[model samples]
Target: MLLVCVFGGLGTMVRYIFDVSIRRWWHHAFPLATLLVNVIASFCAGMAAAGYVYHTVDQATSLMFVAGFLGGMSTFSAAVSEMVSLARNRRWWLAFSYALMSMVVPLVCAAAGWGLVAVTR
Candidate 1:
């Protein structure tokens, strides 16, 4: 539990840093930072899942990674907020695109990450 808390805190800090760093150069109304972070978290989660399945990662560590680190890293609420903001501002197309990408991209990234790890064995 302590380990998970530590990892979760670390994950939140990493997410904040990543968001700030990306926003420095992003200069767009779109929530690119959140999207990228979630995608990354999903990919890492897939890798961790595969690692656990293959007995390369122990249960506690896997729990720490999935429930602690990845949980803190990904931001579904932020994504939805961004979508709502876009829609409120009448950027229908952009909002729709963002919504679709938010759903599909992370899944694909996770699958790709899983396949990469699975193939290594």
Candidate 2:
């Protein structure tokens, strides 16, 4: 629990830094920050899941990485908020596109990450 909390805090900070930097450079209302965070976090989650399932990750490590870091790094709330903002602003196409990419890409990345564990192991 302590490990999870500590790592979660670290992960959240990383997410904030990463998202802020990207938002600064991109300067768009497309939710790129949330999208990137979700995708990367999903990959990490997948890998951590696989590691735990395969006994490569012990309980503390699993709690820290899976329950802590990835949980902090991913932002489902922010993603939905972005979608809502886009729709409210009448950017239907952009909203739809963001929504689609946000779903599809993360799934793909997660699968890839899980498959990566399978392959490497």
Candidate 3:
């Protein structure tokens, strides 16, 4: 429990820093920070799953990564809010594109993470 809390705090701080960094680079109506964080979190979560499957790491470590770290990093609520904001602003096409890509890219990245583990093993 202590480890999870510590890791979660670390993850949250990292997420904040990363989001701020990216926001500085790209100023737009889209939610680039949330998308980037989610993609990274999904990939890390996939890696954590693979770690458990391949026994590269113990269950506790996997849980810490998935439930603590990635849990803190990813923001599903923020994604939904951004989509709503875009829709409210009448950016239907951008909202649709964001929604579609947000769904697809994370899956691809996660699959890639799993494939990486399999291939390496």
Better of 1 and 3 by TM-score: 1
lDDT for predicted candidate 2 compared with the true structure: 0.90
* Model 1, TM vs. native: 0.97
Estimate the TM-score of every prediction: 0.97, 0.94, 0.95
Which wins on TM-score, candidate 1 or candidate 2? Answer: 1
Question: Model 1, residue 71: what's the lDDT?
Answer: 88
lDDT of 2 at 36: 90
Computed on alpha carbons, the lDDT of every model, listed in order, comes to 0.93, 0.90, 0.89
By TM-score: ranked, best first: 1, 3, 2
Off by over 4 Å in 3: none
Residue lDDT tens for model 3, 64-97? 8888888888888889889999999999998999
Model 2 CA lDDT for position 71: 88
Ten contiguous residues minimizing lDDT sum, candidate 1: 3-12
Clash count for each candidate, listed in order shown: 0, 0, 0
